[model samples]
Structures are given as C-alpha cells and as structure tokens.
Target chain A: MLELFQGPLFISILAAMVRIATPLLFSAMGELVTQRAGIWNISVEGTMLLGAVVAYVIASSTGSPWLALLVAVLACALLSLILSFVTIVLKSEQFIAGLALNLLASGLTLFWFQTYIIGRDPPKFAGFEAVEIPYLSDIPVLGTVLFSQRVLTYVSFLLPLAVWFFLYRTRYGLEVRCVGENPKALDVKGLSVGGRQCLAIMFGSVMSGFGGAFLMLGYSDRFVPDLIAGRGWLVVVAIIAGNWMPFRVVGAIFIFALLEAIGIHAQVVGVSIPHHVFLVLPYVASLVLLAGLRSRTHQPVALGIPYRRE
Target chain B: MAKAFSSLIVGAFGSQKALLGSLAKATPLLLVGLGTVIAFRAKIWNIGQEGQVLAGAMCAYWASLWIGPLPYLIAVAVLVLAGLAGGGVLGLLAGVLKTRFGTSEIISTVMLNYIVIFLLAYLLDGGPWMESGATVAYHQSPPVNAMLEWPTLFGQGAAKLHFGFILALGATALSALLLERTPLGYEIRAFGSNPTALRFRGTDISRLLLVVMLVSGALAGLAGAGELFGTSHRLRAETLLGIGSSGIVVAMVGGLRPSGAMLAALFFGALKSGAIYMRLQSGTPAGLVSAMEGLVLLFFLCAAVATRVHITVRSEAHA
Candidate 1:
C-alpha cells in the first residue's frame, strides 16, 4: 500500500485517473444539460453502449476511427428521438420510457454482437494514440496526468467550463434552464417546451455517444457486449451526487474515476483486499454518497414529469 | 427474417417437448414477472430483480450446504424460505434507503445490482463456492445434492418441467387477488395514483414501500431459487442473469397486470426456448431473443401510449 504512493507510481495512478475520467466526463456534461432542461433521461447507459457498438462496427469496417465517432454519435442522436417521442409526445412515464430504451439498446447490441462477432476472428482496429503537448508535456507530474492524453480528454476537460458558460452566461442556456425549472414559463413565453426538450435530449445523447466512442477508440481495441458496463449509470449517479451542478458533477465523476483507477492498480500494487472490493468501489461509493447527500436542492423542479398544455 | 420467424413459431409450439420446454423456461420468468408486477403497480421502481434473483439463489445454495439428511420436502421448503429471505432483505434495504435516507429506489437498486453481481463473482471465482477439482476453476458452484433437486412434473431431459410451474401459476392467481381484491391491493393502486391522498389518510407510506419491495424481491428470489433447484440445479451467473430483465419486460408488456404477466411470460418463455431450437435449425443466435424482448417492449410502450390516447379521445366524444 505504501509503495502505491511512491513518486512514479502515484503519477501513473493520476494519469490513469485522467484517462478513466474522460469518457465519464463526456457523459456527465451531456446529461447535465438534459437534466437542467427538466428531462430526467436515464437512458445514458444504453445510449453509450449503442455508441460503442456503432463505433466498433464502423471502425472495423471503414478503418477510420473518426468516421466511427461521427457515425456513432449521429446514431445515438437519432435514437434519442424514440425517448423524446415516448416522454414528450406520448406523455408516458419518463423513467419507464428510459428503461425501455435501455433494454432495447442492450438487447440490440447483444443480438448484433452474437450474429457478427461471435464464432469469428476478432476484428482489428487502430484506436487513438496519446497526443503529447509540446511544451506542457515536459512539466513534471501534471503534464503526464493532464496534458499528455488523447485529444478528446482535453475537450472533456474544457467541457464543464463551456457548459458552465452556456448555462450561466447565455440566453439560450437560461431558456433551457427555464424549461426545466418551470416549463410553463417557457411555454408562456411562446417558446416550445417539447422543442427545447427535444434539442436538449439530442445534445445529451450525442455527448453520451461521444463518451462511448471515446471509451472504445481512446482505450479499448475490442468490442464486447457488456463493454459499457455501468459507467453510464455512474454518470447518472455523478449528476445526482453532484446535485446537478456542472463542475460538481465533474468532481463526482473524477471521484468515481479515481476509485476505478485505484481499483485497476490495486492488484498490481499488492493490496491485500479482494480485487472485487475495488471493482465494486464506485457503486458502493455512489450509494454511500447519495445516502449522505440528502439534498435535492439543485434538481430541476419538473424533472421526470411530463409537461402538458391545456 | 421470415424464415427465422416461422422457425421461431414452430419451435415454440410445434410439439409436446417444445411446449414443456416453454413452460419450464417460463416458470422463473413468471415468478419474477409476478414479483415485478407488485412493485411496479405501486409505482416504486425496484430495478434490482437481477441482484435479488442472485441473492435468492446464493442464499438457497448456502442453506443447502448446511442442511443434513432430512425429509426431502422439508429441505426444499427451507431452501425456498432462505431464498425469499435473501432477496427480501436486499429489497428492504432499498426501501429503507428511499424512506429513511431519501435515496431514489432506482439508483439504489441499480447500485445494489452491481454490488450483488460483484459479490457473486467473488463467490464463484475464488471465495468458497467455486467448483473444485478442475485445473482452471469454472465460475460456478458444485451442483446441489441430487435428492434436493426439485421433482419433475412431467417430460424428461431438456424439457423436464418442475414444481415451479405450479408455484408460478399459484403466484399469478395470488398476484391477481392481491392487486384487485384486497385492501392492500387497493392501497397499492391508490398510492400509485395519488400518494399525497394516501399520506393524508394517515397511512405509513414507508411501511408500504418496505412491504411492496419485500414481496417483489421475495417473488424474484423464488424465481432464482427455483431456477437453481428446478432447472439448472447448479448456481451459475449466466443461467440466472437475464431472467430479471426478461421478467421486467414481461411485467411491462403485460400492462403491469398479473394475468397479463402470465401470458407475456409464456410468450417470452416460448420465444427463449424456441431460440435454442432456432439456433440449431437455422444458425440464428439465441441472443436474438434478447433483442426481440426489447423490441416487443418498445413496441408495447408505443402501443400502450396509443391506446391511452384513443381511450381519452373516446371518453371526450362520449361527454
């Protein structure tokens, strides 16, 4: 355990944490916009998996990671329409609608994987490599941990800031927030409630898709059905534990990523605890965090409720 | 696609063996679906059926290890009770989280699912329950004692149906009664419709949540235990993992009604059992069944919304 904190190992751990946090940051930033718009879209997990599956297929077939990323996010964006339709047009239970999307996404992924990937030679694909910043890469531990990463990691780092500026500084952001805080107000202002929500859903879903794509092209070279695991759920938890705030959600995601990074390192570090303990750390932490953090203060007033016009 | 569809239909209902296999597969689904019905009706999203199912099987397996040579029926009963206790405790924890800590059941249940799955992996991989005598340890437990395996109702080999079918039928009837004819059922429906009114009536909503979760988890637990003792007869995560999600699909497509769940279970069970035959007949992957479950669920969701709209329009026209 003490050896884990030794200089170089500690820096490596921090680097791993940054890498793991990249995908989650993408998802959290996206989900925050959706939540702020009062749409509690819980289909992030399924959507992310769909993104990954699409990325895998496209990268394998077309031999272009960029094309895979573009196609995957676009597919996820289109898929969000089903959720928007059910929650917005149909006025069904938003949670159930999300649940349906989740099942649909995972189930479809399983089918496609089984039909194509199984009983065949694994497809080979080249994922993104680390792009080192010229001067910044030389700066001791911080450089390796922050500056030397896949190009997307930097975008994810700036994402929270960009989102913060949008939500707190821009008119459209204020209007989107209005849709969540009070949809009737936006509706009364002659702004379409469903229209704003639909846009927000697509944006959130596209970012989530990007997260999935990054998880694939940034690190993993192979496609598995359960590849997304519960990271998408972790993002959702991060949003809640962070109290729907942009930076706070990033903080929560980093905590989860840090735990995951530690879990990845624990066995190599000769930690005495069962590796399963590390595997479950994020989920356990989430439950504990939510149990301790009882405030729903920042939650959108109309989150998960279907809006109606009389 | 059409060939696959025809094969799926024939494989599901073509013969006595096929029909029995369908029922056998449907048993756990029916039990889990019935359990899902209870919680969903009250509008509490207990999404941890997967974990609850595993917990039930683990608990039952643990009990089986301790039980000495006893009357067969008594031993089986003990295991079943143990299964119920395992899943019920997990459900109760979620309920407590929702009521006491203000944690959402959805999040807590999802967390619990991961926790339970990791725990099972630990158990099966290396911790005590791992099967012995192989150079490489397979992630499964040694089969339960042969005497303790649930008795077959009919058929043999792959299509061997067990006592769980009877239990599932009884459960369907009980769920129908509980949701329609009883005061608790009335409260459940009322709570779903307007919890504020129920709270004003001085009802202990927390207790109700706890009860709903307990019953729901217990039913899911029974499904797991039955799957272990009746069908698989060995605890393997793969055998039990998808039943929970399929159960949810059943409950949802059944329109959250017990009888509807039964029909949906049988339908899905047939689809699953047929998938195996479909795999043999036309080289279709069994994973297609999982996709079809999701497809059916999404289609049902759209249809449900459409019908509700249709009914409202009709009522307005009548007025």
Candidate 2:
C-alpha cells in the first residue's frame, strides 16, 4: 500500500488524473457559464449521452473524430432547443425540465442502442491518440503528466483560464452574470434575458457534448449505454461544490478526477478494500462536500427561477 | 404496426391471466407513484425513490431473518411494518440532510441513491446476500422463504396477483384522503404554492419537509417490498430499479394527483406488460417503450405549460 504512494505508480496515477480531468473540464466550464447566466441547466447528463451517441455514430461511419465531435456538439445544440423551450420559453420548473431531458436522452439512447448496436458487431472508430510535445514532453514527471496528452486534453487544460477570462474580463460575461443575479436589471436595460439564457444553455449543452464525444472518441473505440454514466451529474455537482466559481469548480473537477483515478488504480495497487468502496467514493465525497461548504454567497440569485415579466 | 399494436393490447388484456399480470405489475408502480404524487404535489422532489425502495426491501429481508416463530397473520404484519420502516427511515435521512444541513434534497437524494446502489451491489455480489450455490453466484439474495410469500389474490401461474395489490389500493384511497380531506395535505399543497405564506401562518417548515420526505420515501419503499415479497419473491436490484423512475413518470403523467397517478400506473403497467408480447409478435424492441416514456414526459411538460395560459391565436377585431 505504501508503495502505491511512491515511485512510478504515483506518477502514472497523476498522469491518468490529468487525462480523466479533460472531459470534466470541458463540461464544468460550460455549465459554469450557463449557471452564471442564471439558467440552472441540469440537462448536462442527457446532453452528454446524446453527444456520446452521436460521436460514436459519426466517428464509426465517417472515420473522422473531428467530424464526429462537430456533429455531436451540433446534435446537443439542437437538443438544447427543446430544453430552451420548456425552460426559458415556457417558464416551467427548471429542475423538472432537466429531469425530463435526462429521461428522454437515456430512453432514446436505449432505443437506438438496442435497434442498431445490439445485434451487429459494433463498428470501430479511429480514436484520438496521445500526442507528445518535443521539449515540454521531456520535462520529467511534470512534462509527462501535463504535456503528453491527447490534443483535446490540452485544449481542456487551458479551458478554465479561458473561462475565467470570459466570465470576469469580458463585457458579455458581465451581462451574463447580470442576467443570473438580477434579470430585472437586464430587462430594464432592454436586453433580452431569455435570449441570453438561451445562448448560455446552448453553450453549456455544446460543451457537455464535447465531453461526451471525447469520452467516446478520445479514449474508447466503442460505445455503451452507460458510457456517460453519472459523470454528467458529477459535472453538475462540480459546479455547485465549487461554489459556482470558475477556478474553484476546476479545483472540484480535479478532485473528482483524482478520486476516480485512484479508484481505478486501487486494485492494481493491491489495496485490501473492495472495489465498490473506491467506486462509490466520488458520490460519498459529493455529499460531504456539499454539507461542509454551506456557503451560498456565490450562488446566482435566480439560478433555477424562470424569468418572466412580472 | 397495426398488428403489433393489437398484439400488445391482447398481451396486456386479452386473457384473464394477462390482465392479472398487468395488475400485479401496476401494484408497485401505483404504490411508488402515490409516494411521488404527494411529495411532488408539495414540490419536495424526493428523487431518491429508487434508493428508498431498495432500502425498504433490504429492511424487510433483514426483519424476516429475526422474525423467528409467529402466527402467520402476525408474521406478515411484521414484514409489512418492516417494509414501511425501511423506506420511511431512508426518507427521513434525506429530510434531515435538508432540514439540518441545508443540502439540496435534489443533490443529496441523488447522491444517496448512488451510495445505496453501491451498498447493495456490495451486499449481493460478495457480501452476505449473495446467492450461494454450486453454479456461479448471481448478484441476488436466496429466494425469499416460500412460506412467507404474500398470498395471491386470484388467478394462477405467473399472472397471479398478490396481496400487495390490496395494499396498493388502500394506499391510493388513503393518499386521496390525506391530500383532499386532511389539514396536513392542505399544508403540503400550500407549501408548494407559497412557502413564505405557510411559514408566516405558523407551520414548522422543517417538520413539514421531513414529513414530506418520510411519506414519499415510505410509499416508494412499500413498492420495493411489494416487488420483493409479493411478486419477484427474491431480492434483486434489477427488478426494483426501474420502478422508482417509472413511478416518477406516473406521478407526472397523472398531473401529480392520486387518482391521476392510478390511471397512469395502469396505462404504463399495460405498456410494460404488452412490450413483451409486442416484441415476440411484431419484433418491436421493448426499449421503444422506455423511449416513448421520455417522449411522453417531454410532451406532457410542454402541454402543461401550453394549457396554463389562454393563447390568443386570433386577435380581437378593432373597434
């Protein structure tokens, strides 16, 4: 067990954690923007599943991971329209709308999976390979853990900084924040609250789509029904546990990624505990994290409330 | 397609056996849906019905081990109580999380669900509950003691409806009464509509939330117990998992009313029952039903919003 913490095993685990954090980084950053705009979009899970499914389909059929990623994001964007209507347009309960979208995604995925993928041998896709940068990749442990990763992983690593910039340093970012904190002010300013929310939702869903696509094409060659599993929900938790801040949320995402990486490596590390304990750690941690945080000062004022002319 | 549709109808209702089977299926759904209806009516959103149901069955199974010798009637009664206690306790836990810690019930319930599911997987896979035999161990408990099985109401074979149907019916009536004729029910509805007013009116909002979770979780828990003791007669996660989500769907489709949930449960029960025959007869995959559920839910959500306001499709003539 002590050996698990030392030597090459620890390095490999850190490297794996970095790789695993890629999809979550893409998702958490996107959801942070949407939540900042005061749109409590919980449909991240469903959108992720749709993204994975589309990625699997396009990658196998067209033989282009890039094309698959594009189509997957596009598909999720289209699906977000349904959510936008039910949530932003109808002004219904945001949670309920989110739940409905999740159910729809899983049900549709099951149907499609059974209809096509069940009987036939699944088609193989050309998945993303790890790319090694020249000098950066040679920088000992730090270099291997950070520089030598798939292309998308590198993109995701820089996403949070980009998000922090977008959310804090940009004009539209302030408007988005205003829409969440005081939609009435935005409304008074003659800015369209619903329109801002719609775009935010679209962006959030698209990023989740990227996560799902990467989960499919970045690592695996085939797709399964539970591919996204609870990662989407984990992304939502990351947003909240991070107190809805850009960097803090990234911190939370890495924590989850680290736990999951350790869980995956526990058996190989010769731990005495049952695998289930490790598998369940992230969820158990989420409860404890939420209970301990208790700070809602940073939460958006109208996060889940549907905005309407009063 | 038409033939497949007809076959599905026949599979669900053509024979007395099929009808009884469908009713048996509806028992758990109705129970869980009733639990959902009350909670949703109050807008509590206890989405952990899945875990609650599992807890209920697990509790009842534990009770049976220690029950020892007793009269048949008393034994069954104890088991029923155990079932309720199991689910109610889990619900109360969520209630505490919300009332004390300020954790959102939505996130907490969902997290608890994963925890419970993992716990069960542990229990069944290699923990004490794994079915012991010469063959590879399945992730399930040994068949429930046959002597303790809930008595059948009527019919025979796989379609024999168990006594849980009666419990479910009684629960429906009780839920209707609780929501319509009781003060607590009034408080629940009022809480959903306006929590601030209820607080001003001297309601202990925390207690109300706890009660809501307890009742919602208990109802779902009962469904799990019913599925275990009354139908499957074995403790298995696969049999119990979908009932919670299906119940939620039933509650939503029923417009979060007791009577409406009953009808939706029956409809979905039939859909589920018929899916088997539909697959065999017309080669339509059963997964289509699950997909249809999502579509129906999305449709209903939109319809509720659409129906709430009088859309002025045509403009009034100018004077």
Candidate 3:
C-alpha cells in the first residue's frame, strides 16, 4: 500500500485519473446543456463510440491527430442531428431512440473494423501530447498533479467553468432553461423550443464526440472495441450525482475516477484483497449515490418526454 | 411478417447444414427473451439480463470446474441453481434500489451490464479464473469436464442441436403458464398495466419488486447456463454479453406478453441464425444482425408511439 504511494506511481495514477475524468467531464457537461434545453440525449455513448472509431480510423490513415479529432467531432455531430430529427421532429422517445442509436453505432463500427481495419493490432497513430505549464512545472506536488497534463485534459478541466458561464450568464441559456421547464410557455412566447433542443443536442453531440476523441488520443492511445467502456454511462451518473450542476458534476466525476484509480492501484501494487471485489467499488458507489440522490430537487421538469406544440 | 418468414425460411433452412446451425444459435436468445418477458410483464425494466446471463454462465462454469466427482444430476442441478442465484442476486439488487431508493432500474441495470463485462474481462486476464501459464497472449479458464456437456438431441457433426433448445421451449411454455394461470401472474399483469391498483390494495411494492426481479434474474441466469453447459462449456469474455440488447428487442416486439416473447424470440433467433448464414452465403458483413435488431426495435417503438399519438390526437379533436 505504501509502495503504491511512491512519487512516480502516485503521479501516474493521478494522470490516469485525470485522463479518465476528461471524457466524463466533457460528456457530463454536454448532458447538462442538453437537459437544460429539455432534451435528454441519452445517445452520449453512441456518439462517443462514433467519435472514437472515426478518430482512430482517420488518425491511422493520415497520421494527423488534429484532423482525426475534427472528423470525429463532425461525424458525431451529424449523428446527433439525425437523432434530433427523429426525437425532436418525429416525436420519438428519447431513451428508446438513444438506445437504438447506441446499438447502431456499436454494430456499424465493429462491422467496419472487422471488415476493413484488421492488421493494425493496437490501432496506432500519434497520440495527444502533454502540455506542461512554464512556471508551474516546478511547483512541487501541484506541478505533477495538475499543470503537467494533456491539452485535452486541461480543456476538460476548464469546460465546466465555460459551461457554467454559458448556462448562467447568457440570454440563450435562459431561453433554453425556459424551454426545458415549460415548452408550452416558450411556444406561447413565440420562441422555437424545437429549434433550441436541436441546437442543444448538436452541441452535446460534439462535446461527447470530443470526449470520445480524448479516449483514443489522450489516454489509451489505442482503440479497442467498446473502448469508451461505459465512461458515457458513468458521465450520465455524474450528471445525476452532481444534481445537474456543472461544478458539482466535476466533483462527481472525480469521485468516480478516484474510486477507479483506487481499484486499479490496489491491483497494481499486488494487494491481497480480491481484485474483483475492488472492481465493484465504483458501480456500488454509483448505486449508492443514485439512491441518495432520490430526493434531489434539480431534475429537469420535462426530461425524457417528447414535446410538441399544442 | 409473411415476407420476413419466407426470407427467414429460405435463409435458414435452405440447406441441411444451415438448418442445424440456426437452431444452435437461437438457444441463448430464446432463453434470454423468455426471462425478459417475465420481467417486462411485472413492469420491471431489466436491462441487466445480458449481465445476468454472463454472471450465470460464469457461476455455472465455475461450479462445473470446481465441483468434481459429484453425481451428474446433482451437478446439473447445482449449475442451474448457481445461475439462478447469480441472476437473482443482481435483479434483487436492482429491485432494492428501485423500491428502497426509487432509483431507475433501466439505468441501474444498464450500468450493471458494463460493470459485469469489465469484471469478466478482468477475471479472464490475470484474475482468479485466469488460466495458468504464459501471460503474453490471452488466457482463459479451464473448460468444463466433457461428461458435464449437454447432449445433442438431433443431427451430427456441425449440425448439432443440443437439449438447451428443448429447455428454451419448456421455459417459454412454463413462463406462459406462470404468467397466464396464477394469482402471482394476475399481480404481475395488474402491476404493469396499472401500478395504482397494487398501491391501493396495500400490496407491498418492495416485496412484489423483489419477487419479480428474482424471477427475472433467475431466468436470465438460465440463459447463461444454456451457453455454458449447452454450447461453449466454458465461460469466456464475450459470452452472453449482448443477449440483453436482443432480449429488449424481443420484449418490445412481443409487447411484453409471454406468448409474444416466444414468437418474438423465435423471430429474432431466426434472424440471428439467418444473419450468420447471410454472412456465409452472401459474404454480407458481420454485425448486420445487430443493426437489424436495432432497426426492429426502432420500428417497434415508432409503431407504439405513433399509435399512442394518434389516439391522443383523436381524443383531443373530439374534446
């Protein structure tokens, strides 16, 4: 246990924790914005999968990580638009459609991967580079803990603040909240509720896609099947656990990441505890957190239900 | 439906070997779909059926691997019980979360599915169940004793049709009876169709939930056994992982009725078996069945919602 806390090991775990938390951060932020606009885009997982696979394919082909990231975000945004067309325009169920989209993404990606992208073993390309802060790099523990990280990780850390500012300080953000709370009232006021939801979902899709990109290029540096690995679902839990607040959501993501780190660390150090028992910690914690949050008063009034003008 | 049948028949039974393979592939989906039907009738959104099936397979395989020299009948019973226990426990966990804390079972069960997959991966790679020896390549748990393997009722060689297919049929029959002819069946139907009635009658929602979830999980656990004792005879990483998704498609298509689930399961099972044949015959890419499953689900949900919307529109126009 003490050996696990050595400088390099501790730093590596912290880095891994940050890496894991980045995608959750991006996804939760996207989900928060979507809910604020009255659309529950539960297809975050699907969008992330699309992003990861597309990004990996592009990166492998062109050897340009930035271009790969661009394609990933754009492709997933298009997928999100398709989802919005079905749910927002056709009045489909959000949860059911979201689940279908996830299945479609998983199936299509795997089919292509098997058919086309076989020989590359680890799905290789140049991964994201760490961005080291100039002055902060020498600051004892804080330097290793925070300043030395990937560019995506830094963006992930700053995203909650940006999202918080957008939601709380912008007129459009207020409009989104109004639409979520009472789409009928928004329609009465001649505001396009459907339009706002469409925009929100697209925005959420891009962020989720970026989150997927982070998984491939920033952390794992390789694309395995289902590589997003329930991080999207974990982000959904973080959204609830944080009571839908941006900062609180980050805290929730961190808690889960810390639990994951502990589990991984416990195994790495060859601890005597049954590793599977430790593996169950994050899920059980999610269950407990979800249970404890039953009384929270911040749920969107019209979440998961379709809306149309009367 | 007829067009689908004609295509399905041509695709599945077009050749002698094709007929056998389809039956082999359909067994797991049939078991999973039957389990899904029970839970859906109780209005329990059990998305963990896949995970439950995985857990069931693991436990059944574990039992077979460890409990040696036991009588064959006792071993089989223990294997089935192990699956039931595994699935029931997971379902009961979902139930507790639902009743005691008001957590959404749909989300919880879905999350549990991922957790189980990860747990299985870990188990196969360096965990307790890991096969001893070289660590460079993938390692797996030891296969079950050959004596413990389920017998094929028909066909030889590649056309093996095991007893699990019969088990699936018996499960569907038993589920139909339990759901249509008992007091508990009435309660399940009542709860799903209208939960307000159960609340009004002072029936403990928590207790009802426990029973429903246990039954749901147990049946799914049997699906795991079907894969293990019936086919693979060993627990592997991907075993029974996606059956939950297929089960959901089946349940939705069947409208949550037991008889409907049986038909839907057969439909899906045939689709899957046919899809494999489709891959072999047409050189169609694999994972097409997955997309087709999604398409079927999308069509079903759209149909349900459209009908509901039409009714609302008509009623509102009348008002």
Candidate 4:
C-alpha cells in the first residue's frame, strides 16, 4: 500500500485526477449557475453529447480545434434554447422535456454517425494537446500535476472562481438567484423571469458544450456513441452534493474525478480487488454523498416550477 | 425518397410476419408504459424504469435457474413473481428515500438507474451468473431453461410470436381497470390531482407513494421478464436498456393513460420494426427511428402543455 504513494505514482494519480475533473468541472460550474437561477436543466447529458459530436465532426473536417469548440457551443446552446422554450415558454414539465431532449440527442448522434461515418475508417485529428506553464513547470510535486494541461483544463480550473464571483459579486447575479428563489418578486419589479432563466440555461449549456469538447479533444481521440457517458448526470450530482455553490461544486467534482482516476489506476496496476467494485466506486460514492449531504443543501424554492406573469 | 418510404412501410406492416414482429416489439413497451402511467398519474416520477427493468431481468434469470427443477407452470409463476419483486424493491427504495430523507425521486431514480446498470454489467461480465463459455466481448447470462420460456403464439420457425403479447395486453386492461374502478385507483387519481387534500383527509401520502412505486416497478420488471423469456432468451444489456426510455415516451405520448400508452407503444414499435427492416433493405439508419420517438414525445409534451395553458400575446404598445 505504501508503494501506491511513491513519488511518480502519487503525482501521476493527482495529474489524472485533475485531467478527469476538467470536464466535470466545466459542466458542474455551468449547472451551478443554472440551478442558481431556478431552472433544472436535466438536458445537460444530451447537450454534452450533442456538443461532443458537433465538436468532433467540425474538428476532424476543418482540422481546427477552436472552430470545433465554437460550433459545439452553438449547437448545445441551441439545444438549451429548445429546452427553455418547452419548459419556460410552453410551461411543460422540465424533467420530461429534458429526458426527451436526451433521447433526441442520443438518437440523432448515433444516426448521423452511422449514416456518415460508418463502414469506413473515419478521419482522425490530434485534438488539443497539453501545454506546460513556463515558470510553474519547474515546481516540484505540483508542477507536472497542475501546470501541464490542455488549455481547456486551465480554463476549467478558473471557471468556478469566475462563477462564484458572478453569483455573489454582480448585480445580475443577484437577479438570477432571485429568479429561482422567488420569480414573483422579479416579475413585480418589471424583470422578465423567463428571460433571465433562459439566459442562465443558455450559459449553462455553453459551458456543458465546452466540457463535451474537452472530453473529446483532450481525453479521447475520436467521438464515439454516447461519448458523454453520463458525465452530464455526474455534473448534476456534483452540484447537488456541493449545495449548488461554485467552489463546493468544484470540490465535489474533484472527489468524483479522484475516485474515477483511482479506479483506472487500480485496473492498470492489476489490483487484487474485484474490478467491478472499482468500476462502481464513483457512482456509489455519488449516491452516498447525495443522500448524506442533500439534506443540508437548500434547493431553489421554485426550481422546477414554470413561472408565469400573473 | 418516395420509393424508400414505401419500402419502409412494406417492411414494417406489408406482411403478416412484419405485423407480428411489430406486436412482439410493442409488448415490453406496453407493459413498461403501463407502469409509467401509474407512477406519473400519482406524480411519483419513477424514471428509473431502466434500472428496474434490469433488476427484474437479473432476478428473473436467477430465479429461472432454481425453478427449472420444479413444474413448468409453477416455475414460470415463481420467476415472474421474483422479477416483479426485484423491480419493486428498487422502486420502493427510491420511494422510501424520498419519504424518509426528503430525497428527490427524480435524482434518486436516475442515480439508481446507473447503479443497477453497473450491477447488471458486473453480474454478466464473467461473474457467477455469466454463461460458462462466454467471452469478455459477449457479456450475457446463460440461456434461460426452455421450460421457463414464454410459449410462442404462432409461426413455427422464424416468425414465432410469444404469449408475452397477451400478457402485455392483459396488463394494460388490468391497469385501466385498477385506475378507473377500484378505490385504490380513485385514491391514486385523487392524490395526483390534490395531494394536499388527500393528506388532509388522512390518507397516508408516503404509504400511497410506496404502493404506487411498487406497482409501477413491478410492471416494468414484468416487462423485463417478458423480454428475457419471450424474446432474447438470455439476459443482455442491449435488449433491456432501450425499452425503459422508450417506455417513457410511450407513457407520455399516451397522455399518461394506460390505453393511450398501449396505442403509443404500438406506433413506436411499428417504427422500430420498420426501422430494422429499413436498415436491412434500404440502408436507412435505425437510430433515426429512435430520434423519431424523441420527436413524437417532444411534440406530444408541447401539445399537452399548450392545451392546458393560455398563451397571451403581449402588444408592443404595452412595453
């Protein structure tokens, strides 16, 4: 067991944790903002998947990661708009609408991939590559673990801080929070609750899009079916476990990523424990964390309800 | 494009064999949709039907192993009951968590879906229940005992339909009867319409939730059993997972009614059957059918909301 904590192994595990946490951080931060505004966008899973496919297709065809990321964000934002229209404009049930979007995304991605790319070797392009910070790379233990990452990973690390500031320090942030807690107040004050919630959903979806892009470009070489792999759900779980706080959401994401990284390392090192146990550790951990911490977390009062002008 | 469309129709229902195939595919959706209707009517939000189905399938498969030595009729009954219990317990856990700890059923159910799926994967992936000769690539349980299999209805060789279709129809009838005639059904509808009023009248909301979840989960589990005994003859992930989500679409498209779900399931099943045929004959991707299902659900949801809510257009002069 002591060998597990050796210099190289420890640093590598920490590095893997950081890498794995990047996408979750992006989506979780996004979800935190959306939830703060009182809309439960359950379509995060679907949006991430759509984003991954859009990014992969564009990147492979154009050979430009930046363009791919931009298109992916737009694609996911479009999906969020649909979700907003149904839930906010039509006043439909948020949960079912989100599930429908997920099914649509999954089916569309698989259909497009099969129709366009199947029966042939699809083109492959090197996605975003890791870059080391000039001065920080020389730091001992922390250097390789934190300083060397894809540009997306660096952005992900700073996102929670930015979200925290937006939520607490800005006047617009106060309106977003109020929209969730009491939309009637916002309506009486001549602010459009639906408009604010719409923007929040769009912002959250764009972040999820970036998360999906990072997953495909930084972690994987190709876009596979269901490539998001429930990371979107994990983002929702992280926000819940964190009590919807941006920094706390980061902590929750890191914990899940740590477990996932350890699970992968355990498989590589040929640990004697049952592989299934390791495989299921992160999911089980989320369940436990949710059941334990959810009681303490206060949800937005009108989180899932459709707000209307009275 | 017109030729391809005609062929798709021909592939789905042009022949007796295609019609039977569509019926077979619709059976599980109908059963699971009935289950979803019950829960949704009660405002339970049991979205973990996918996991419940897996749990039921695993349990039914396990039960079949021991019951094979008994009388065929008795064995089948035991297997069915076991499947129901397996799914019911999972649903009950979520319900209990919601009532006891104030957990959101939606989140818990969704999380349970993943947990149960992983558990199924663990069991099938060279675990104790895996077929002895199965390789790593093909994770599945051993074929269920022949006596435990649902008897086919028609077509001796390649076009065999199973008794599961009848079972699904019976479940639909039973659900409609229970929801419309019985006191429990009346109470369920009442709870959905006004839980506060029901609670005020001394009806136990938590207990009602538990019962609703159990019935809902049991129906989904029975669907899983039908798939195992009627169609696949073995426990596999691919056969089980898609039905749960599709069942939701069926339930919603049916307007959360049993009869409506039955009709919706038939339509979706026809599309699925036709898509398979379309893929084989005309090279259309089967995933398109799945997307169509999503589209139908989305449209129906929008319609459901639109009919109920009054959309007032604002004048630019007011601004």
| Second chain TM-score for model 3 | 0.89
Model 3 global lDDT (CA atoms, 0 to 1): 0.80
List ranges where model 3 is wrong by over 4 Å.
A120-123, A262-280, A292-294, A308-310, B1-11, B65-75, B132-138, B278-285, B306-319
Over B138-210, each residue of candidate 3 has an lDDT whose tens digit, in order, gives 6456677888877778876556788878878888888888889987888888888889988899877788888
Tens-place lDDT per residue, model 4, B102-193, is 77788888888888888888888857877786556478887888778888897544345788788889999999999999989988999988
Docking quality tier of candidate 2? medium
Order of candidate numbers by TM-score, starting with the best: 1, 2, 4, 3
What docking tier does model 1 reach?
medium
Docking class of 3: medium
What TM-score do all the candidates reach, one by one? 0.99, 0.96, 0.90, 0.96
True contacts kept of each: 0.72, 0.68, 0.51, 0.61
Question: lDDT tens digits, residues B160-237, model 1?
Answer: 899989989999999999999998999999999899999999988999999999999999999999999999988999
Q: Is candidate 1 or candidate 2 better by TM-score?
A: 1
The candidate 3 chain B region of ten consecutive residues with least summed lDDT is B1-10
Candidate 3: give the clashing pairs: none
Candidate 4 lDDT, tens digit per residue, A29-62? 8888888888888888988898889889899999
Q: List lDDT for all candidates, in order.
A: 0.91, 0.88, 0.80, 0.86
Best by lDDT: 1
Candidate 3 DockQ vs. native: 0.51
> Which one is best on TM-score?
1
lDDT of 3 at A245: 81
Write down the DockQ of candidate 2. 0.73
